[model samples]
Target: MTQSDFDDGNEDDVPEWADRVMADVAREVRRRRKEMKWTAQKLADRCEEIGYPIPRNVIANMESGRRAVLPLVEVMVLAKALYTHPLRLIYPVGYVEEVQQLPLTYPVDTAKAMRWFAGLNENYQADHRMLHHHIAHASALERALFAVQGEERQRWAAERAIDDTARAKALRTQADFAERAARAKDELCQVRSAIAADGEPLPDLPDTLADVDPAEGYERDTD
Candidate 1:
């Protein structure tokens, strides 16, 4: 039999562990391909360009968990072509025993506080009340200072400048509140590293959350 035909042995010859590993690899390959928005043919083309003799049928067999043995060279080539680590493609299933799970405590909902503060200005009546009370009070003080003359004007200007500085500081505080609130709502995933049975912990997660801004407002991008 040809080497390719010999390589494609009957299912019974494969060990259970090998079968599991191949299955995991197949699943991961399919997942990575889909994540990269590449078709089987596109992946094959990329492999060909990278000097790896990977055909569409070979890709299909690998993804279908039929061709179990993956050479290190091919793994490296595929990983480079797909922008991933070679180890990621080979050992897709992480040994849970090797992973260190940390105790995670969820933080209090700061976003709710910000939302509540924002809602205060949502209604027209509430807005009008703020305008007449807080805003008008401040404006009145500004007008009073501007209306003065000579030394009184200078003194009033200094006082008004202090008020303006205070108002600016308050606005900055509000902005920080908003930022912290938005950060609180973000979905977080933390992975702790652990020493493997005979290897080191893989630094990268299979999937990750990326920051993306929503068209309308700030949003936490996650996959």
Candidate 2:
């Protein structure tokens, strides 16, 4: 028998199982790209810009199940570009089940997670503060521009009005941030309570954590 026939594993010459796996990978790549609102050409351009240099035709071939087995580095590049894990592309379905069955040897990073949460809380508070500042400035400008008359006056007044509107909108956004901060604080409290109930030392909340209290006259809701 010829080498091609021998490689095919039968006289009927069916595609190998490896081909199917590659096809699945390709399909997933295309599917994720589409989900991210990117076209094949757009994805190719992004890949090239990111130093991966995948051609449109190669992408098309892979999506169409004609190409098999991408390089490991290429798989990693693709996953980074797609904002997904490399294993999601490489492993077949149900592989995560196998991962879960493995023993957990590493300690969970509760401190890191709490730190991240606190950082987000601080960012939200900063946004709210900035928004409040803008609102105050806009309101002041609107008040200052009220006495002028003429086209120049009219223009300034209109601009101030727009700024005032923006300020109001910013206030609403600030309220949203406050609500989110409150929820995060509640979560932290719950976690602390759980730890206390277990007779463990109370984990200190991160210094980055924001103090969000509606009773302090910080508006919790704007509308």
Among these predictions, the greatest lDDT belongs to 2
Instruction: List runs of model 2 lying over 4 Å from the truth.
Output: 1-15, 92-223
The digit string of per-residue lDDT tens for model 2 on 93-128 reads 432121111122221233333334334445653566
Q: How far out, in Å, is residue 76 in model 2?
A: 1.4
Candidates in order: C-alpha RMSD to true structure: 23.0, 16.8
Q: Cα deviation of 222 in candidate 1 (Å)?
A: 58
Clashing residue pairs in all predictions, respectively, total 0, 0
TM-score per candidate, chains pooled? 0.35, 0.36
Task: Give model 2's clash tally.
Answer: 0
The digit string of per-residue lDDT tens for model 1 on 48-69 reads: 9988868888889988877968
Displacement of the residue 55 alpha carbon in candidate 2, Å: 0.9
Query: Where does candidate 1 stray beyond 4 Å?
Result: 1-14, 93-223
